[model samples]
Target: MKIVIISPLWERTPPRKYGGTERIVYALTEGLVKEGHDVTLFATGDSVTSAKLMSVYPRSLYTDGVSWSNAYWPSINISKAIEYSRKIKADIIHSHSQYYGYVFSPLSPIPMLHTHHGTLKSQSIGKEKQATLDYFKKANYISISRSQREPMPYLNWVGNVYNGIDVDSFYFNARKGQYLLWMGRFTPKKGSKEAIIIANKTKRKLILAGKIEKNNRNDYNFYKKEIKPLIDNKNICYVGEVSQGKKVQLYKNALCLLNTIKWDEPFGLIPMEANACGTPVISFAEGALNETIKNGHNGFLIKPNNLNGMIKSLKDIDKIDRLTCRKWVEDKFSVSRMVTDYIKVYQKFVKK
Candidate 1:
C-alpha cells in the first residue's frame, strides 16, 4: 500500500527534546516501512525517517529560537503536501495533527484517516473550530485512547489504537534499582508536583527527567519554586532533557517509574516503556493508565493525584513479573501491533 503520513509541523518526526506525537509518528512510519509497506512521510525538514521524506517547514517550529513565521507558513507547506500526495498517487493519507490537514482531507482523492493524539480537555473541547471538526468528520478518526474521544462525539470512532514503541530499544535489566524515575514534560498537567510529593512521602531518591517549555513561564516558575527545593539532600535529581541513551539507562536502573498525571492523559507511553525495561510504573488512575497499567500486573495504578497511595503502591509494584511485563508489551503495545492495526484500517477503506 502507498501510505502518506501527515505529521505536525511543530517538531521532527522523532523530536529532540519533548514530543510524544512526533515519536509516535516516527515509530509508526518505521514500523510500517519494515512491514513492506510503501510509506511517504510529510513533516518538517529536520524530521529523519526511513520512509520517503517530504518537508513542509524549513526547520522544526518547536526549535529553541524559532519565529512566528515558522508557525504561520506550515499551512502553505501542507497545501504542497496535498498536491504532492496526489502527484505521487498516494493510496491513503494518515494525519497526526488535528487542524492542519482538515483543509486538504476533505478534497483528497484517496481515503484519509486522522488520529487525535492529545486529550480534548475542557478548554479546547467546545472551542474547537467547528469547520475544522466538520472537515475531520469527512475522514476516519483514530483516537489514541477512549478518554481522548469523549469530547468529540461527532467524529467517526473507527478505533482506539494506543501508541507503541520498540521494546528491545528500552533495554530491560532485571537486577538494577537505584533511583525512582519521573519521565515526561515538566508541566502541571503531567503532575511533576505530585511526583515530588510522592517521592518525599516514600523517602526514595527521585530523578525528574524532561524539558520545561520556555513559553509556559508560570509553569516553569512552579517548577522552580515548588519542585526545586525538594531537589536537595541527594534524594531528588532534576535532569532536564534526556536523550534516547539516557532514557533507556534511567528506566533500566530505576526502582520504579513515577507518572502522577492529573489530566485525562491520552496515552502514557512512559509507563509501557518502564514496564518494558523491567521497571514497574506507579501512576495515578487516569486516561490510558486504567487501560495500560493492570493495577498489579505490569504496573500499579492508584487513585488520581493520591500521593500517599502512589507511594504505598510502590511496594507491590515489584510483585509484577518482569518477563510478563515484557510479554505484555509484545502482545499489546509493540510498534508492530500498531502498524498491523493501521494497515487493517487502511485496507478497510481501500477495499471499499
Candidate 2:
C-alpha cells in the first residue's frame, strides 16, 4: 500500500527531545516501513527516517525562532504536502495536524485518515472548527485516548490508539534510585509547583528537567515566578532540558516519576515512558492518566490537584514492583502494538 503521513512541522520526526507526538510519527512510519508498506513522510528536511521524506521547509520551524510569529509557515507546509500527496497517487493520507486537515478531507482524492493528537477544548478550536468537524462526520478520525473524545463524539470515530514508546530503548532497572523525577515543560497545567510541594513535604530529593520556552510568556513567567525560586540546587535540582539518552537514564534511575498535571491531558507519554524503564509513576487522576497509570500495578493515581493525596501515595510507591511497571507498558503501550492498531484503522478505509 502507498501511504503518505502528514506530520507536524514544528519539530523533526523522532525529535532529539521533548516531542511526544513527533516520536509517535517516526515510530509509526518506521513500523509501517518494516511491514513493507510504501510510505512517504512529510516532515522537516532534518528528520531522519527510513521511509521516503518530503518537506516544504528546509529545517524545523521552531529552530527558526520565528515560527510562532509567522502563521504562513505551517499554512504552506500542510498545503504543499496535501498537493504532493495527490501527485504521488497515495492510497491513504494520514494526517497528524490537529484540525488543519479537516478542510481538505472534504475533497481529498485519497481516503484521508486524520489523527486528532490534542485536546479538543483549546482556544484555537472555536465554534466554527467544531461545526466544521461535526459537518464532516464521514471523515475517519482517530483519538489518542477515549477521554479525548468527550468534546466532539459526533465525528466518524475510527480508533483510540494510546501513545506508545519503544520499550527496548528505555533500559529497565529493578532497583529504585535516590531522587524523585519531574520532567515536563514548566507550566501551570503541568503542576511543577505542585511537584515541588510534594517533594518538600515528603522530604525527598527532586530533580526537575524540561525546557522552559522563553519565547512563550506564560511558560517563562511561570518558571521565573513560581518554579525558579523554589530550585535551591540542594534539595530541588533543575537540570534544564535533557536529551533523549539522558532522559532514559533519568527514568531508569529515578525512584518514581511525578506527573502532577492539572489539565485533562488527552494522553501523556511521560508516565508510560517512565514505566517502560521499570519506574513507577504517581500521577493525578486526570483525563487519561486514570487509564495510563495502573493503580498498585505500575503506579498510584490520586485525586486531581490533591497534593496531600499525591504526597501520601509517594510513601507506598515501594509496593509497586518495577518489573510489573515494565511489563505494563510492554503489553499495552509498546510501539509495536500502536502500529498494529493503526494498521487496523487504515485497513478499515483502504481496500485490499
Candidate 3:
C-alpha cells in the first residue's frame, strides 16, 4: 500500500532530541518501508527517513528558531502535504499533525487516518473543542492509549494503538546503575519537582534529562525555581536534553526510570524506551503508565503524586527482573508489532 505520513513541523521526523510524535512517525514510516510498502514522509527538510521524503519548510520551525506562532507553520506544512497527497494519489494519508488533518480530510479523495498523539483534553478546548465536536466524526482517529479515549468516547475512533519503539536502538543492561532517572519536559505537570523530592527522600542519586525551551517562560521559570536550586553535582545531576547515544546510556544504566506525572499523559514514551534498555520504571499510575508498566512484574505503578510510595518502590526495584522489562517491550512495543497493527488499520481504509 502507498502511505503518506503527515508529521508536525515543530521537529524533524525521529527528532534530533525531544519529539515523541516525530519519533513515532519516523519509526512507523521505516517499519512500513521495511515491510515492502511504498511510504512517503511529509516532514521538515531536516528530517531523515528510509521512505520518500517531502517537505515544505527548509528546516524545522522550532529548530530554526522561527518566531511565528505555533499554529502558522503547521497550517502551511499540512497544506503542502495535502497537495502532495493529491498529486501522488496516495492509498492512505496517516496524519500525526494532531488537528490539522480534521480540517483537510474533506478535501482529500483518499481515506485519512489520524493518530491522536496527545490527550484529547490537551488538544480540544474552547473553540477547538467545538470544532472537533463538529468535524471529528469525518476523520478516522486512533488513540495512543485506552485512557486517552475515555474523555471523548463519542469521537469516531478506529482503535487504540500503543506507541512502540525500535528495541534494537536501545542497549539492554541487566546490571543496573546507582542513580535514578527522570526524563521528560521540565514542567509541573510532568512532576519533575516531585521526582527531586523522591530522590532526596530516598537518598538516591538522581539524573534529570530533558529539554527546557528557552522561549517558554513556564518551562524556564519552573526549571529555575523548582529544579536548578535543588541540583547538587554529586547527588542531583541535571543533564540537559540528551542525544540518542546519551539517552541509551542513561536508560541502560539507571536504577529505575521515575515518572511521577501529575496529568493524565496521553502516552509516556520514556517508560517504554527505558524498558527497551532492560531498565524498570517506577511510575505514578496515570494515563498510559498503568497499561504500560506491569505492577510487581517489570515495574511498579504507584498512585499519582505519592512520594512515599515512589520512595518505597525504589527499595523493591531489585525484585523486578531487568530481563523481563526487555522481554515485555520486545513482545508488546516493538516497531514490528506497531507496524503490523497499523497495517490492519490501513487495510480498513484502503481498497485492495
Instruction: State the lDDT of candidate 1 residue by residue for 1-352, as single tens digits.
Output: 9888888877777987678888999999999999998999988888899999988566777675554334355677667667877888888888886666666677777777888876766564455455567656756788887777777677887777888888888887777586888888877888887877777777788889988766667777877787777777478888878888888889888878888888888888888888888887888898878888887888888888677787778877678777777778888999988888888878888787
Model 2 over residues 1-352: C-alpha lDDT tens digits? 8899988887888787787789999999999999999999988899999999988887777777764546476667667767887898888899997667777787777888889887776464678667778777778899999988887777789898987788999999999998999999888989899999999998999999998977788789999999999999999999888999999999999999999998888899999999999999999998888788878899999989899898888889899999999999999998899999998888887774
Tens digits of per-residue lDDT for model 3, 1-352: 8888999888888799998999999999999999999998889988999999888887878877775356777878777777887888889889898776788777777788889887666343456655664666657889989998887888889978888999999999999888999999988888888988988888889999999877678788989988999999788998889999999999999999998898888888899999999899999999888888889988999988788998888899999999999999999998898999999989987755
User: TM-score for all predictions?
Assistant: 0.93, 0.96, 0.96
For each candidate, the alpha-carbon lDDT, in order, equals 0.80, 0.87, 0.87
TM-score winner, 1 or 2: 2
Model 1, TM vs. native: 0.93
**lDDT for model 1:** 0.80
* Arranged by lDDT, best first: 2, 3, 1
After superposition on all C-alphas, the RMSD of every candidate to the true structure, in Å, is 2.1, 1.7, 1.7
Candidates, ranked, TM-score = 3, 2, 1
Clashing pairs in model 2? none
